[model samples]
Target: MLRLGCDVRVTDTDNTDKTPDFLAGHGDQNCHIEATTIDPADNPSAEDRNLEDAVAKIKTLDSSDFQLRLIVEGRISRTLSKNELEDKFGKLLVGNDPDEVRRGIREMGDESAPYAEIRGRNWCLRGELQPISDAQKVEGGSRELLIGPMGSYSGDASREVREGVLKKAKKYDRLDAPLIVAVNVLDIRFDRETENSALFGKEQVRYSPNHPEIPAQLVRKPDGVFIQGGHKPRYTRLAGVIFFDGFVPHNPRGSVCLYVNPFGYNTALPQPLYELPHAKGVDGRLNRVEGVDVGFLLDAKSPFKNSGQP
Candidate 1:
């Protein structure tokens, strides 16, 4: 809240505690601040569960470090079992000498097997593999090894976030004060335009060759989530949403994006918190977005006012 210019103080509450997440400000000016996360597993389908399992298995490898950049095919095999694939991969790491490493692993598997190669003057190692056909996706492979961040939001993934926000928001429905739900859009292919449609109402997703940089905004198409007289967000009780995009959630070094709902339907919307100065033009905190935008904090107030301080 200090990031928003609020003279806020937070307190801890245990699992069985009925108290809200925070007691901001001091003395009589204090207000309740409840927080929750939008977990991907809360509402999962059979496929979602399966995919989650796959990701979990990949994560267990303990040696892979990748994100939006993924390795779906390199050093992979559609025909080898997981163990067999791992064995082949291990061969390529046999020694420090690149020439010896390649020669040593050459006889480890079939000549057609994908292998790892150490390239670049500084030895930028890479897994090399080819694509698999549709038949392979379901039947040809014994097991496949994919290393990367969850890419692209499937239809289910998109709907999940919408449902997730509302579901979490409902927890604070009848609360005395405004509520905020912070979500980590992990492994979610989220588009701002599509999300606005999910929240406000239906909006067409348009594509133009000339404007490829921007997704179709909330254009308010003729037949959308919002009709002639009303908006679509049924759970207007939610006052705002805070988000952390990309791989890790709540990484100590990451930043957050805030969105405030001004609609009256959220009758109890916590204006006090939302109104707290953002450190930016609005509720936006001027910090490094995607945790890597250049020129961040150039002319913006530091969003970490309370960092390293009590």
Candidate 2:
């Protein structure tokens, strides 16, 4: 973020009680900074955790013991608790037959959907797993396996962005300076226009792919808070909302990326903050909007640039 035009001076905080994450000054002007992400996936319940652990343990079992690998399907992730999960595993121990274990779970259709597989293990449970169950489960020749943060795209996740911004804004409503919220959209399938609607409260409309100019009337989205009375009384202290998308120019070797925030900036920017050298994000892929400037989208891409053996 230092690479951006918002230059700042580090100042020590004397407050010992409730406060913002940290304080910064752009020249003599200052504000509070809070960082967050745009994730809408519901937290897994204790039952969900048990299912995951059970699947992980099942994956470590000897693959040769069954007629086929212990392919339990991924549908049960959110429903199974430790005891229930143990019962499924115990079914496998009953006869040393893999087919029996597979049959014991379900008929292999409907409620129990195949989520992922590693070696001989599988998981099936009930919960709202995202990217939905229809996402490609087969990778290479391997069973469909989930490897990272799971989610599906649409308006709900974007609403999370709004909720996060408003909540953060409210948290620092009493602060004497402007409040800026930085959101990470790396794991999300973020649509720029959708997020804008969420922020400004516009009915994010869409047209049919078959007819370029044709519009869809019945499915119109309602006005969001920014368009209604939602933003007036609550977001008064919010000075800016910044987005951190992933880096650009993918590669096995590292490559730089750009960050763009379509919204205009805060009113309390410091003179020194404006005076800092502008960052040439992704070698000028991003143009300078009036209030938006270049920024560093690091941390997400930095972890892998090392030898694994250390």
Candidate 3:
């Protein structure tokens, strides 16, 4: 059995004919747990309804502290808008950055009360989008980078991108969330000769990722720059790099696609996808084999720093 935390107790409530999934205890308090099975038919609105049902059931428990966890076959994609998701369940779940919420609530004049009390004492639940892979099964060494065409990177844009990435990483560092960089590949331009070609004949594009000095020739119209030689034509360049905290499906050829989890906050480039190298066989032709990777950033000092209760 996969255990998220030692204090958390997992039991099958199916035999009891209850919709609740399991029960957990925090100190002397008993928290009612509900595991909702979500499918394509169960959209955000449906999920919200399920949450309401779970909350109603949880309130009937002898204890006031209870939570609801949702387990699904895949990530919950395209259910609620960002504002809506945060509005309804922001306080209940642990976000990428607890400081942001604390600051927000404090700014609203609630400094006298701590966030933990507001979270624990209330009859609220934290929605966990439990993907197929539990935290334990997640592997390491699955990280990759994606750089866009030369024109996509605007003047001093790379610095901005790097800074944004670092900022988000710092915020989620405590929660062990991955850092993501989204680059727009559609805004890149090519040389006159390679402009109309399917294959990228530019030399600089291949080495853009490791290039120390960003080139000025690859500048785009209003702003932005691009990498010269990427995997595809105009669309072949790297759009972004996603640092996943756990195992995620990888399509090197950039074919198979899945949506990101909408429950928790994401810092990676918003909605943009990256282009990957094509799968090759002995004859240098296309081959079909699914790839998966688990990318995570490590702290030099303590690897198990983010382990245990939040």
Candidate 4:
């Protein structure tokens, strides 16, 4: 059972009009628990879909009462690009004393400079912060700096930019503390599929396993990868994921066939007997073995009555 802390109740629905397997709390202020379990056969895809649904449900609630916390098992997945990282965190790097740091960087020019005190501690500006004749490089101990012509930067460039910003922010007491980004992987996909495949016949490749390197400090779970934001000094966790199982067909040909059986009475038969000339007996046995699809329960406090809280 999983425990979620929400200030308000949660609700959910599925693509089919069938009542969603949902439970929710009621009151002006209360914690909520949502419990969901699918057949082990539908583990991967179904769990992913459930996580998306749960997150979406939390987002729709009124933001005033309670903060939301999620605990999920299984594999969850998401992709983050450099632009997205910047969009979520760029402003934090703009130091309170921009004018002062800008002057320092400008003074450093193109030289491999030694560290100088920004507030009191030393900082070395390795690259020219101003408009450059060409790409510029700066190195101060373990930190590296680079500046490129406008619009000539990539995502890696932003990481360097943020690092530079953090150094600048350290010099000023008036500025807000550097913002942190946090991520938690509730699950990760271990099964191997095609690693890199082109999407939509476009020349561009999708799902590059070797691209967009992830940091080692982040934790990996059964569902997905989690990433933290900001320079290491001000790192914060930002996201989490829940993994689920996937289903693949045992017989490719049978999976592709679209024909439906005309005998509605035998709809419940297992695959092996469904194709037989006389399958009525098989249908009877199938009915006997089939368990009721007990709906999920959504209580105000606990969702998965089994998985404990994080």
Candidate 5:
């Protein structure tokens, strides 16, 4: 907020624990902002749990020239224990020729990649070996198998985002100023659809009332954090919600976006917030305005060059 020319101050609830995180004043536009995060750990799926366990077990194996892109499918194979996995995958890596695996992957991609599998009646764990590039390998050094961070499955991304917003909404009863909840949604599958569903409710198709000729028109269900069922404006104390994914210190370039509440009890949000990339309802239609890049707001540079590699 300091970067946005807002006079920012930490909120004190007069020794009480309940309070918004902070308050920002920008040219007579004062609003209370609460910041929160939606972490992946809080909502783990069965696939994620199994994949995490499989990776944890296999990443401990020794590998000199290869990294494993592990794939876990079906049920958590009761047939293979963690120690059994380490031993079997370890031997598989040690027995395979890294040169042959590399050549095959280069020739046929995943189809040619040498694969190792251990399967039970209902479950399977598989690993495909790829040669470790020189940049990743240390000189004359052997290391634990390098396991790439991938293959994570999404677990109700919209539900997680909704729960995060609901938790913040219920944090304080009624603040004097406009309340803006800033949610840093950290999930693999979080996107515009997830955000729209979580905050504005799910989309549905209905016939236009005024124009009966229109067969279908997209409309959102009122089952949202801001607009609940019964078609009433809920959480009116909330002026807006600011959300983004994959935000970190010194890097706000996820380009913070805002959703203004049409039925907010407080006055409109400050002009500075409008300068952000935002979505707002106008004439019952949601419109997104492209705004300044967050990098310009904070004068922060990307850690990577134009090539997108550090």
Candidate 6:
């Protein structure tokens, strides 16, 4: 809001948990803004927990010369015993030549490429050893392992967005003003489609029983965050939702967009918020309005170049 030139103040709810984060005024218009974050999928099975526990133990291995990368697949029916872990991984790491492993690491352009492999009755583990710095070797630390992206699963972004919006809507129900829920989605899969599906409903094709002559018509299911069956609006207090995909203070390059709820009880927004890129529902159709990039408002140097990472 500081970037948008709004005179913002922290909201107080008499020490109540229902308070929103901020109240801001811009050009005679004002609204309550609540910020939230949707993290990656967290529903893990018992097998998943077992695998993670084993990985944590692997990270504690005492190897100074190389950083271990573990590519895991399949189900862990039983816990991997410490002796079995050592036999499969420890012996291999101890006998491997560091120079040979470094050359193998360079030869494989793909980061997922593994230099060694081990298997159990129901699972397979691929290991990649990357040579560490001489300084790191001297100052020994736990043999931390980097997890492969393939091993991590991010669940549906639409479900995540819906749950996030609903949770916030339920929190600040008594606030009488227009409320904007700003969400920072951490999942890489979050996109325009995800946002649309979460707010409007998942698109599907259906045929009306009374109008059999009519061709199959595309329609939205009644499962959106702000919509219910028969295109009825719900969560009317939510004026809009501001979406930021993986946007953090350190990295501001992520796309910023808004979804204005057509059914909101108090849909009015401050002047600065209206200028942002937004999409609105009109007669069940979404109309997207393009606006200035957030970076244009900041007038700052490139976020990537000035990131201070060497």
Report lDDT (CA) for all predictions. 0.44, 0.44, 0.28, 0.24, 0.76, 0.75
**Compared to the true structure, candidate 6 yields what TM-score?**
0.65
Query: What does each candidate score in C-alpha RMSD?
Result: 12.5, 11.6, 26.9, 25.6, 6.8, 6.5
lDDT of 4 by residue, 1-310 (tens): 1122223222335434222222222233221112222232333344345444434533333211112223332233342233432332222232224344445547764242221111112211111222211222242122212222112111111222223223322332321111111111112221111000000011223343676574334222211111122212121111111111221222111110111112221122223221211212244221213211112112322343456754
Output the number of the TM-score-best candidate. 5
Candidate 6: tens digits of C-alpha lDDT, residues 1-310:
7777789988855746568888988877889988889875454446667677777666656665656667776756567766767666676667777776667667865463335665667677666666776676777656455545245333347877888888888886747678999998988678888988898888889998999999998877989988888778898989999998887665577788889988888988888886788888788677888877885555474445667765
How far off is residue 286 in model 2, in Å? 16
Residue 279: error of model 5 in Å? 2.0
Candidate 2 local accuracy as lDDT? 0.44
Q: What's model 6's lDDT at 4?
A: 73
| lDDT by residue for model 2 (1-310), tens | 4534354443325544256665666556776677665553454335346545755654443323221223333323344344553445434333344343345444643334222222223433322112212233333234422233232222234555566666766664456776666666543446555455556565545668899787665332444423335333235456556555543333322222222222324446444333322222245243433332233233334455463734
Among the numbered candidates, top lDDT falls to: 5
TM-score for each of the candidates: 0.45, 0.44, 0.15, 0.14, 0.70, 0.65
Write one digit per residue (lDDT tens) for candidate 5, span 1-310. Answer: 6666689898855746488888988887789899888887877666567667777777667777787777655546343467778767787777888778877878778688777788766556777787887776756566556555444443347777887888888878888889999998877688888888888888889886999887887888987887888878898888889887778765655657888987888856677888888988889888999977876655454334364555
lDDT: the better of candidates 2 and 3: 2
Give the per-residue lDDT digits (tens) of candidate 3, residues 150-184.
11211112323323333322332222222223221
> Between 1 and 6, whose TM-score is larger?
6
**Candidate ordering by TM-score (highest first):** 5, 6, 1, 2, 3, 4
Model 2: ten consecutive residues of lowest lDDT: 126-135
lDDT for 246 (candidate 4): 24
